[model samples]
Target: MSTPQMIRTPLTELTGVAHPIIQTGMGWVSGASLVSATAEAGALGFLASATMTIDELERAIVAVKERTDKPFGVNMRADAGDAEARARLLTKYGVPVAGFALAPKQALVEQLKSDGIVVIPSIGAVRHAEKLQAWGVDAVLIQGGEGGGHTGAVPTSMLIPSVVSAVDIPVIAAGGFYDGRGLAAALAYGAVGIGMGTRFLLTSDSRVPEEIKRRYLAADLNGTVVTTKADGMPHRLLRTDFVEGLERTTGIGRLVDSAKRGLEYRRVSGMSWIEYLRDGIAMKKATGRSLAQMAQAANTPMLLKAGLVDGDTSAGMLASGQVVGLIDDLPSCEELVDRVVREAAERIRAAGATLVG
Candidate 1:
């Protein structure tokens, strides 16, 4: 069979990928299996390192490399204690990209740049794109509010043009992009391609449990809600009874539990408890999030890992996009990517006719 031609963007050429599409780094869910599959299908895939230890990240990189000879990225917490170790693996393993899951410091950017790793931090606003670009990032992935997991407030339609207009580097649009029409729209807005989290989460390559996946499919357009009750900033999640319970909780119990979890995260991750609190304070200072909310933020990802990886639905929280309502079937990574690219190409051509007249 002849390979269908795609309108390769500068990013595609720069990263040695066919399309400019990327799979968003979902904590625990975006592991070796999903990341390798996407990379093998010719789109950049990011290994979610937010929950994984540095050694675990090393194993994941090797595991993906063993599965496919294609290039893939590893996503890391920008302020993580062992971020430098992940950077070392990127240089040692020749990882194609280093994706930042949070606001990165200048030192982290320099550490990766000196090793020749292409740094691309996912951003939700225009200023962030400019900030990363100024720090010598190669590209930016902008996730609009329609995106799943923890997301920004702006919608994809506005964020795409906003970030693209602000930065000279390649901009990848994300959020609520489940099909070719969405991908086509992103290109029209001047994005190199689209990035997807929920779309990828619903794919067969993703290792999310059947029951959880089904719950996501059962959600309605209004099923997802933004709540800072789980983490510091607004987080998009499936509106589950468990989630509602947390949001409704008051008094000393909530505060005590949050403090305990924060300590546990610090210990397990090899960070001093005081340092963990300091990080929370710093994040609060930077984002203007309240002290209580920042304390809650320290433990959110660990809770997410329990649900996503361990399938402990009762204990873990589900971070999802509002688009889960639109998803019904789980297609293989290859099938999903091909369908999206094909449909987008057709749509783009059809739209051209209207403009020419």
Candidate 2:
């Protein structure tokens, strides 16, 4: 079949991508390969940099540039110790976009915008979106409860329209979105596009291990559970033996485990104890997370690495969206983007036809 004509929206116009689909930056899953492929396929992709050191992130950025000249983004924690330095590195490379998991400071947003980089932050609440927009962010991506990892209680259907109505900036809807039908619905709801995490992570171009991919594929719609057991915040993850054990553990036991993981992370990340403490303090000030929650935050990357990179499901946790059950195949990024765009155009046209004069 001939390729479907490209559908342009505010997101596509701002990001310079042919399609409005966004492949979210999933730590340990989103890397150079996936981001480049997504960019080449005419969608925006973000390199997950929160898990990487500043040097690693620069290298990853260079790797993506080598693979594709298309515009892409790098996702980072706004409160990271090296955030300023990372921002400078992005400027050095002339990266097109910068994405933040948490709301960045006004200064950081200004710096990126001045450097000609589009700043898009992910938010879970309408207030957050309004604040980001007021702070002059280029756009915002809002993830609902059905999305993977840390999520809010509101479903996407309700959350998208709420934030869209509140913010003048472009809004990209996430959570429970995986295909063309979702794209159409998001646009109808006033969003400029849809951002997908789990759907992209399950793609053939993603670097997630084969075993881990199989595990994700086997899950049914009911296979995901949202629990605060992994971290102090509500995190959505696959229902695995490891996750179940975490849910069953007492608060004290979990705290002890969190301490252990925090130490392990410090070692793996090569951060001095002083540096670790500083980062913890920054996280506390930014998110208002308690000390215990700060320690538990260390568990997220380590556990995800074990499952997504090492393929050890028993030893690690898998962050996934409720949409996992809806996925069955591992199509390449190009094919997936093409199919979704085509289907969205057709659905939108069909829906418009039903409107009475």
Off by over 4 Å in 1: 1-5, 267-290, 355-357
**lDDT of candidates 1 onward, in order:** 0.82, 0.91
Tens digit of per-residue lDDT, candidate 2, span 190-265 = 9999999999998899989888899999999999999998878999999999999989999898888888877888
Badly placed stretches (over 4 Å) of model 2 are 1-5, 352-357
Q: How far off is residue 117 in model 2, in Å?
A: 0.6
User: Cα miss at 131, model 2 (Å)?
Assistant: 1.0
TM-score of each: 0.93, 0.97
Per-residue lDDT over 1-357 for candidate 1, one digit per residue giving the tens place of the 0 to 100 score: 212548688778878888778888888799999998998777889999877767778899999999999878998877665567778889999997989876678888888888888888888888888888898888888889987778888888998888888889999888889899988888999999888888898888899988888878889899988987776578898888778887887746676777777777777666666656665665665567676776777778777867777777777788988888888899988888888888998898888554353
All predictions: root-mean-square deviation over Cα? 2.3, 1.4
Q: Under the 3 Å rule for N, CA and C atoms, how many clashes does model 1 have?
A: 0
Give the Cα error of residue 68 in candidate 2, in Å: 0.4
TM-score top scorer: 2
